[model samples]
Target: MKKPKTTNRYCKFCKKRTSQKLAAVKTGTPSSLKRGSKYRMRKRGLNRGFGNKGKTSRGALGSWKRYGVKGSKKISLKYTCGDCKKVGLSANTIRSKKLQFE
Candidate 1:
């Protein structure tokens, strides 16, 4: 997908319409200290000591590479106000194989 470098958009902070610069939003890596990561680590430890864990004892049937493939990537975009220098997030996410700014 090709997006315009600059577009006229409404600036909520400024309370008016202005020409804004378009930029893609990049996500940062997850922290190991997060709550989800800690819970997963505790769950794995519990399965190790138990005699019978039912279906979990068998573990995964196959490698993760064999399934759950996605066709496209979700891209997030944001616009920067030219006057106020404040950034605003786009309302919707785009799914595409490639994204380019024109």
Candidate 2:
């Protein structure tokens, strides 16, 4: 088990140093959301060489892996100042498994 790291930093609004709570931040929208809700709507046109209505595995994952695995990105957290309630992120990229807030 690893210990959680918290930062005590300067808060501009509070005009003093304060404890900042760390939290994981997601970078972008989910993969399923990058495309519109395909199942929800009944589409009339072709999607990926076949009609969108049929329930089938498109084998897109196999072809997609031809490029090789992408690099694993470290999880980033948003640090919110306790005193001023202001949110801040690290100037440098820092990765953590989890953040335990007190």
The lowest-lDDT stretch of 10 consecutive residues in candidate 1 is 56-65
Q: On a 0 to 100 scale, what is the lDDT of residue 87 in model 1?
A: 99
lDDT for model 1, please.
0.76
Q: What are the lDDT figures for the candidates, one per model? A: 0.76, 0.57
In the range 1-102, model 2's lDDT, one tens digit per residue, is 143556787777787888977776776733352333433222323444656533323444335433234444466667788777888776665544443455
Using TM-score, give the best candidate's number. 1
Tens digits of per-residue lDDT, candidate 1, 45-79, equal 57688543442233341233233367778899999
**Residue 94 error, candidate 1, Å:** 0.4
Worst 10 residues of 2 by lDDT: 33-42
